[model samples]
Target: MSAGSRVELYAAIRRDARAGMSGRELQRRHGVGWRTVQAALASAWPAQRAPYPPRASKLDPFKPVIDQILVVDLDTPRKQRHTITRIFNRLCAEHGMTDVSYPVVRAYVAQRRPEIRTEHGRTESAAFVPQTHLPGREAEVDFGEISVRLRGELVTLHLFSLRMSYSGKAVHRVSATGGQEAFFEGHVHAFKVLGGVPAGRIRYDNLKAAVAQVIGFSRQRVETDRWVAFRSHFNVDAFYCQPGISGAHEKGGVEGDIGRFRRNHLVPVPEVDSLRELNEFIDDYDRADDDRRIGHRVHTVGEAFAAERQLLKPLPVEPFETGLWMTPRVDRFAQITVRSNRCSVPSRFIGRQVRVLLHASDLAVYDGRTPVASHERLLTKGACRLELDHYLEALIRKPGALPGATALEQARAAGAFTTVHDAWWAAACKAHGDADGTRALVEVLLLHRHTPHEHVIAGITAALRAGALTADAVALEARRAAEPIDSAVPEADGHTAILTPDAAVVASLTHRRLTHLPADTRPPPTVTAYDQLLRQTTS
Candidate 1:
């Protein structure tokens, strides 16, 4: 019987005995064993049942043998050490210990193996130096790679992580590359997301974007010129950790944060249409993370951040422009290739050098003081980013080129060339010949330089309904559609110029009167005409 049951029985038996009831009656009432009843009647404290009797283990005789094997393994290479299975096999074959189960031998080895290793002095453990972080004083930065499906294709995205040591708050963003521009852009984005920059210092690994050279065995670094400029621009200082493997421990917080966030939130590969969409998901995940507490800290991360934010350096008046500037010559195709991806420029810029500012997500091509073109940076290799407008003039000369041109294809994909455009082009081709029709379509596309897209579409629809297949007619209707609804007068320059009464009066009043006849003209011929006028007045 259990101790509680025995105790109950004992109390009951004592109570019944005090009442002059016999032990037999007590046993009959409690339905307990006879021995239990006797014990209960004899003693106040109930005795616990004895544990199961000890039996000789099958592994006992082989204990010394297993110990000897483990001792020998200590000297051997770790890879050749004796596993439990090996020990069990040796016990059966060498020791001739038949009928010994593997589990029996395994259990003995497991309990005794650690002791043997300790005797041999092979066990070791790692120790970490405790760290203290002041609020908004220190942060760590790192980049990790994640796979995301963008536009139905799996793409490798570089994730930049910045973690505040005090609050355990972090900011994460995905970039197309780990290039210097992206590195700088990531910092700008992280600072904005955190609402300010760390007041004291930020630590980093020896990323090539930041560190140009590592001097000797020390952590002294020669930072890249652009990186130094960026640091100066932000008015923040940087501390580089020991280079390579040894440095991983210095930024352990961010290292751990990257792994934890990746596992908790991004384990199932994210599906998104663009880097922008993927970052929105990351932003939401970061906001949700503020509710979490770091380890056993009483305050949540957001609460801790609320305190730390006050200690941080106030944000600068303007964000630093995060990009790399280069002068690249436009190729014969009017395209400048960046990182093996082609981006189009104006045809007039071909064979001439232009300024290219390559940002993390986009790039701008400039001619001296004028911006020639801008495009979203292509992440994939050998991909081309072309704007059809850049090639419209050239395509007008080679009308046949518009149908199969790469620029046209890009335009169609970007929705700049819509189904309405296609319908108008086909209608034009039927009304005119193939070459002339393509030229007309190109001219209509050129209207986008001045007309809004919705206005152009409306014009196309209106012209199609009115059976006006001419590009000029289409452009006129598009401009009319774009006119303001509340204006009292229509635009003058768009339609042909006409002499309104106000314009006629202003032109007539502004004409200059001749004071004398020019030497080159017949002099005094005006006097004869005046004499005739006077003669008519006298009559």
Candidate 2:
């Protein structure tokens, strides 16, 4: 009923009429309605009976080419090549046809091509291979390679995906490096997405992510300990397809799914700026895909997953630790390099063995069973740094004897000691010419470990005021005090003064007399000679 079909019908009807064929015969030959043949005949020759309106042609431009290719290739052997692909290639290259897309070209070629004949010239059954699937019983897993632009560089990323066959629900996770970590991460994400694990089994190809070696038809040697732990944790059975033969009908669903997802979602090479942006876009895509119902099913993928939630086993009490474990030798500096980042342990641990846990973004240093320190993963290689503050007490005890003592220098540059304390030490070194001052100041800074900053500042002020400008002097005074106390007490005339009622009364009277007098006030309160003698005697 399309325009191209109508044109072809008109041409066929005119040719048949000139050949003395009836309208019925024309209709049968061209597979058109009788009215369509009549209308074409009437429009071409009008002397006879007029028929109804003509049907339109759907593929007008390529019909003649399709017919010619089919006629010429009929006598050729079927194993030589595909005539359809040849026709399309010729149309685009030699004929310069740009509008003929692959699907449209395929449809035209299929219409003209004769059905395959058996040895006896009889037809054979050509039915589609139906996919074997059960509700909540089957899942397909695969890894797809995709190009993503991250941090101004085009990176080829591997996306591991799992999809339930019946519900068409899917979960996918991406990683820059396709390894055991990415593989397990994908499974974890898929379990989260499906809401529950599938009732039947998980199907996979013999990817290195899942299998170490194929020993037999029913056995596979898996290399990663974490992978074994993962399957054990989830309590789900895993089934791997034959190695290198990824074409089983049961697994073909995920194959087609990869093409569909790549075309519909990852077109133009997915130019995302960051991993987070790519993840958000992927989440939106998953939501949209989950909401769409397959065929006429009443339940969507999301709804189906929700219904199947209770069937899944509970997640392990502790989440799978996605880290690479390795035994690293602690250098003389008591440091280990993980992913090129330097992390330090206690100085006593030098030349000792330790375990390092290297994650995607962090490195955890462990001495025996105890965690010594953790640091952010460094992106670049070379001498990465860890602060000595993390092991300052241990380092201080060893002092110059400690390896990688630059940590101490870094602490000094950050002003870990007071300037006055430093000055007192320098002056003491000049006066007494010894490290006793430095040691004394170090003790003073240590004393402030539990003391408030303000209190330390007041103590330093008191020590300086009390003529303890050198480290030795300050230490002497501090030892004499011993107990923690406020150092901001006011001094008067080389003696500690106390406020009393008689003194308050005298001060108030003096203030009143001074205010009542001129701007340039004179002393108004004079201790009488007798009172002065009594105060001096009391002092």
Top candidate when judged by TM-score against the true structure: 1
> Over 4 Å off in model 2, which ranges?
1-128, 145-158, 216-226, 245-250, 255-285, 293-299, 310-324, 333-349, 360-362, 368-372, 375-539
Candidate 2 lDDT, tens digit per residue, 1-539? 56665676687789879999877787788887877776787775323445788565555766776676665555668686456677788888877787657787887666545443333254445455777566777889988888887756786777777888877887777665566666776777777766667778888877776677778665465545667777777877788776665335448777777777778899887777556578678878888887877689899888876665666556656677667888888787667766555777766677888888865435677887898777655444675565554454553354333233576565555555456655665664565444454444455555555555455555665677765654344444554345432333234456655555334212244544675787857778766888989999999
For each candidate in turn, the TM-score is 0.68, 0.46
Q: Compute the lDDT for candidate 2.
A: 0.67
lDDT of 1 at 463: 93
Span of ten consecutive residues with least summed lDDT in model 2:
500-509
